[model samples]
Target: MSRARSHRWLRRPNGDTTPRFAYGADYNPDQWPREVWHEDIRLMREAGVNVVSLAIFSWARIQPTEDTWDFGWLDEIMDLLHEGGIGVDLATATASPPPWLTTAHPEILPVTASGETVWPGARQHWRPTSPVFREHALRLVTTMAERYAGHPALVAWHISNELGCHNIYDYSDDAARAFRDWLRARYGDLDALNSAWGTAFWSQRYSDFEQVLPPRLAASHPNPTQQLDFKRFSSDALKQYLVAEREVLTRITPDVPVTTNFMVMGETKGMNYADWAAEVDFVSNDHYVLPGPQSLDELSFSANLTGNIAGGRPWFLMEHSTSAVNWQPINRAKLRGELARDSLLHVAHGADAVCFFQWRQSAAGAEKYHSAMVPHAGADSAVFRAVSALGATLRDLAPAAGAPRRPARAALLFDWESWWASEQDSHPTSRLRYRQEALDWYSAFLALGVRADIVPRGAALEGYDLVVAPVLHVLPAELAKELTAYVEGGGHLVTTYFSGIVDENDHAWLGGYPGPLRDLLGIRIEEFAPLLDDETVTLDNGATGTLWTDEITLTAPDVEVLATYTSGAQAGRPAITRRPAGPGSAAYVSTRLGAQGLTPVLARLLAAAGIGSELPEEARGHVELAVRGDGDTEFWFLVNRTDEPVRLPGVTGDVLSGPTGGGTADDPLVLHPRGVTVLRRPAGR
Candidate 1:
């Protein structure tokens, strides 16, 4: 039998001419007085919020006791929303369980790797493997699905809130047992498991399945391999939870899409989005851009990654603060035009819909200060006006903006397992950070106005002309094979410090520093020394910089040095080098460099690979370019994300701009800040 479709994802149902645009914010009428429901609906309609995500944290009200469920309030709320012509993205109400449920079934609560049982207060506090939690949670979802499966306003089913809470994996006895079962099913034999884990080194062999325990803070070894295994296990455990919940929801509403919101690039949680993609219908993520120009690169990189996760499928901007977030160390409102700019950028990249974390600001709670469409001051506030303006724009531009677009010829490999393993290592340089390093490379590209895709290391490497893998610590054997093949097949590959150290199981590769990639990279690492103090590295090729000191030897005869360490004993040695594999070339950097030091080298490589940084020579300066292609048409978006007024380029006339004109190749067009222009070209150039 074919698998059931996830109901919380986007689906082009009935081939409707009016494309489905989920222009809505999260709603929690449970907290508001009953008298206010009508006003809220009216306000939502005014703001063009056609959909509202409801019941995200309503488990407490729905199941006051294990045997009793109260649906009277929910029925009224659903009816009200339906009457208002708003679609419903119904949440499973499993984000947080009620205090009574936890008190009655304590086993359902999650235990951290540190042995602390995560209590009932926070969201994502449930244990995935717990029978009680699964039984109770499934019942809730099943009942809701069955009741609302054919509801006119129901558009999708949100399975649960963010999968892993503070951290990934629960080390409860139940979780441990479930993990062992998962491993047994995956490897099929104890010998294979032992070999994969390299159990002989630390005498950590498991005599029986019962001896296995979930990787925990107490039992975790400093060994990179063990730590990496723990990371993988944690990711799998969390994925299993999502799959279980998805299975239940799909059974009830197979026609609708299903999804869960992801926190972008969070490392401590151990959720690898790529691993979760196959199970989800499409991906949705929360974009919480830090409040400053400094965070722009991070925000763009995250947006790029989210786009790639859905395989270029349009994703929902599930939750962003409409004004300011309450939880950050210093919460501040987004400057007047900043929020709109950020949201537009998401669309410029790959987002199909934009929504805020909340519809109304909370009056009492930890999130009371969190921004919302309507603040505590009510519907007449300035924040509400801003929201209303955005809604109006979305409604007007929905037809044009909702269509998809693909980016240009850049690709960055994001390996969550490698990130987890690299950090788990006890001996690697303490300065090494997985996400930060990846972000650094990504930022370099974005700063130069180069559009890139953030792909998993295992994604198909053929389409990309430039593949950059920075700090790829744990190289999955399959990915290693693909990388080698890609480089040998004439693609340019760039990798940096502390890469290829571990295998899939997170065990150190015994052969050399870059164990699996040593042959592919044509280098041998003789010794790795930590740079305890500040130092500089100068390349023989005129590039000079400071880097954590490490001495490496070139094993490949064809390799050529690019940069050398300046101060340490490894000074004048190759800090960076390139070698030809087959049809293409491979570049390796032995140490990390700041953005200034890295960007020039990256530009050189990109240029050498024949990738164009500048847009068509005829294009104007102020017009930022983004391109996405379907079968026969290439959609190009020219957006002015900057604050000042600017001119449009070439010929573009859609609803965004009032009229169309094909100017001479030399003529330039001007556009105001926050203006967007989309142009289309037929396929076959």
Candidate 2:
């Protein structure tokens, strides 16, 4: 069943015998006049929209009151969409419960860490552990599944939109009980729980399971183990909700593919999407371009991560903006051609579809200021023109949807447990950001036009020449063994400070820092001298360290220093170390390198590993290069994000977009500012 579902992921089922690649937006037909419904579909058909995600937040309108349902309007909405040759990714409409249900069962609402009850001014207010919430939510899912089981327009089932986006961790009494039960299932006994949480140190040992509670209103950073379990419980609790909804979905609409939109932006460590990927038929994600300097890099990083999450298969680009957003303090509009640039960038990674937030602009509600496909300026607007043009552009390249992403030669080990543990309070420094530290390395590879997949810690390390694990604060012994084996088998490794220092329960490894990896890295840390935010230290080898610095001493004869601190109390100590391990070598950096310093450090590592730049010096920083292939055909998608044109040398292929008759020996591909060119070639090259 999983294999069959995987086959249906990259494209619509072949049985449809129609044009593929879903292109549309979230449709809220209830927001418009009944007379405006036909015009909405007409404009959709005109804009080349073949898919519409219907009824994402219509629970109130659909149910209205207890013991009542109005499927009459939904019936017309589905029929009209099908009549216009548009497929429906029908939603369960359970994201936001109606006011009636919340008022009737107020206990279902979530409570924050400070004990404030979260009311229903916004969406997703119900507590996942509340039986009142669960009963009503499951009933809604069952009803929707049964009603749309055989509807001709129903192509997929979207379950509980963006599960746990607004309310991930609730500190309510219900959640406390649920957390205790989850702990019991994990630890099996109170004694095991007490030991794992290390209750003896804090005099907080529990004698009974009922004594446990969510880590809340703590005096000073509650037990780190309790914090870790709460994160785990929160993730698992949401997954349980998805499982319940899936049970109803498959029981009725067994044939309809099921999925939920995942908000998988950078550093979003609340929910581990790697585990959630297994619970769905096909992976789908919603990404909003971060409004800042590294926005483009972030978009690429997240899209690559999403594709990797889907296991190299093309996933859905469920939601993005056509222009400005409403949430950020300084909402900025997309520059000319930025929309097409952003959308195609996802496709270059592995998006089988191009979608947005809404079909029409909203004149009311919190999100009314958010951009849409059809702007308030009407279909004749420039934003609408760009959306229409992107639709036609994507529809022409439908054959590339099912191809796999080219295998990465380097892997960045991304661990969710580390992300949780690193941010715990009372750490060495609050400046140790998990995502930024990761993006620092990831951006280096991106800037050099080299592609690397963000892999989980447990993934096989046999495929890559180099593996990088940054800020691996808590290391399980099994993973430690795996890293050792990876280096012994001739794979290069790079790890940072505060790694291999503890077990999974936040218990420090006894004897010294980097306990299990000491021999591999050939270094010992006696103490840490974390620098203040404004302090900076230079290295003897021309690199600079900031944010963190550790006092290091060589423990092995073969260990070599790559950099040494030339300032502060830890002066003359090794800041970076390298040592040979069997067939390959392992390197460690004991302090965060400055932005300019990482370039040279990464250069030395890449050169040592025999991994070279993917593009020429001319094309290195000028373009974004990504490859997707199967064994017969390969596609090289080059996107030029800058304002200047980029010239590609020795490039000839079936140019998806360019002059007539495609590429020839006489002409090389040249991408204009913010332009995208997808060139196809034989895999034999």
Candidate 3:
């Protein structure tokens, strides 16, 4: 049989020419009685849920006892859903191991950095590197694969529920040994490892591999080198578990795609989705933006990260609340049109599927108050109606959306090593956060309507016309070389303060400020000025900027001044500069710029790099822009996130049209409050 589309998981059966939608929400059958399955299926059908992710946390129910296995209930449920025309995204049910397994196999439990044994009952309590846990998990997966490998309803395999609920890496004996093995494989020798980690600095030289310990959070004076290693080790540790599970599923069910849902912008989870992307069929993410005024950016950034993980492949919005989420301190219902608009935004930003956390509202447990497709009363609530309407629209537009487009020529390099190194440095500024700085630049670019890709520093830098690396504290030697080559080859490069200070291990590089990139930037550091809380600085453009400086340096030449500290001993010094590097140009910001001060500067910079907003020049206000690509086809997603309707000059169809904008890209489209529209250019246009 011909394989399904390489990027999308086709929900419709082979030989069936009927066009079908491929989006749905997670269903918890175990939470409700079996009698409710029929009603749930009817409701799902009405809500346009063609696919249902099942048995995510059913490990305890499926195999309550160590040796016993039960698939009868799940089989019935899957069959019932299939009969109702809903496809299945079957989960392996390895998210939360049964209580009995932990009690029977105490070694399966994880130990924290402070020598605390994580008890049972909480989710993600298992030690990832523990052979005992791995063996049991494998058995669970293998048994499920064998049982449901050829099930007609199976469309995809969900490896586990949020792979890093408790941060996968542990310092237990099992994990420690595995860390050593991984290091050996990467470095090949103890000598190379020693030099990489700079073990000689603190008498930490390892004669034997056994001397190494997993980096803990509670170190008296944490070694930055050890900390960086720990981060990499933790990410790899989770990879081992996911790879093992994917290997088994792929072997038995090669036709079915497999994936694990990742959390957006989560650091403690120990999940490096970039590394996990290779093994997964497609990257999926759970987006839960805390209810607030800034929720739009939070949602957009999450979707952007998910898109990045799949290498621009359309991803699944695996879990989102239809209304209010109970986990936050203040749970506010998503405004009238927010849910529909947000869901469409996902599609516009390359989401193949949009699924919620639940099908029906729970009556008990921690997530009881969480929103669902069917509210607690099981009636057609406002959220449910909106979900149903969107579902119908998706079914009608399935074929058109099945293959969209994404075109991006700008990129922002996001490095976890650099983030860790900058934050963990016992250095000039304690208030410095790598993600915040990166987001500042990202927000600026997005506001200006630039389609930018968030990538790793090590990714190929040739294709991008403009590259932004903000607060890249740790410059991997190879990546530094690649960036040098990129700038030398006429690629526009922009970097902020605290960049290129250290190597991958967080150890400072000798010579000058931005040590590795100094030659390319044509500057060096003389001294660094640390500003007190909320200090203001003035730029050459007559804009005032804020500085929470803990360190400032002026040790460079051939730089044009951009900004200066308004009050300080170094009042007249340049806080930002630009210089020529070979055929291209480089810009450097010596300090963080506030919102008002940063946006215009970035707009000017991006324009100079030949990237501009696809939106009409007359468009204004809180607008979000995203581009999705499928071969030569491209789709432009425009979202007016404000409270008022905005009219655009371009002709575009309303992807979620419902008596709002007509379904044709003929005249100017008017977006209602919190409105989203996807405009597609026909292939080969």
For model 2, name the residue pairs that clash: none
RMSDs, each prediction? 3.0, 2.0, 3.2
How well does candidate 2 score on lDDT at residue 152? 86
Candidate 1, position 42, lDDT: 92
**How accurate locally is residue 206 in candidate 3, as Cα lDDT from 0 to 100?**
91
| Residue 190 CA displacement from its true place in model 1, Å | 2.9
Worst 10 residues of 2 by lDDT: 1-10
C-alpha RMSD between model 2 and the true structure: 2.0
Q: How do the predictions measure up, each by TM-score?
A: 0.92, 0.97, 0.93
Model 3 per-residue lDDT at 549: 32
Highest TM-score: give the candidate number: 2
What tens-digit string does per-residue lDDT give for candidate 2 at 1-685?
A: 1222443542243475453567999999999889989889889988889888999999999999998999999999999998898888999998999999999999999999889999988999999888789999999998888888888888888888888888899999999989988998999999999999999987999998988989988778789899999999999898888888887888887778888898878666788888888788888999999976577878988888888888888788899999999998988889887898899888888888788998999989999999999988989899998898888887777767667888778888888889999888888888788877777787778666677788766678889999989989889888899999999999999999888878988898887788789888998886668889789888997877888888887899998888888988788788888898877889998888743567678778888888877665677766888888899899878888688877776666787753223333366577888888887889746
lDDT of 1 by residue, 1-685 (tens): 1253332355433444575457778899999999989999999998888888899989989888888989999999999998898878889998787888888888888887788988866676787778888888888888888988887778777768777755467789888888788788878988888887778877788788778777777544544554566567777877777788778877777787888888774343478877787777767788787754436566677777888777777788888777788877899887776666667667766777788989988898889999889988788887888888777666655555545557557799998877776666366466667787787787677556577788875678798888999988777778788888899888989998778876777766787777888887788886676555465666665654543545778888998776766666787677888888776888888766665567778887888788865454433233456665667766566666566765544444333432244633565455456555555566425
Would you list the C-alpha lDDT of every candidate in the order shown?
0.74, 0.84, 0.75
- Evaluate residue 609 in candidate 3 and report its C-alpha lDDT on the 0 to 100 scale: 75
Q: By TM-score, highest first, what's the ranking?
A: 2, 3, 1
Error of 2 at 636 (Å): 1.1
Query: Which candidate leads in lDDT?
Result: 2
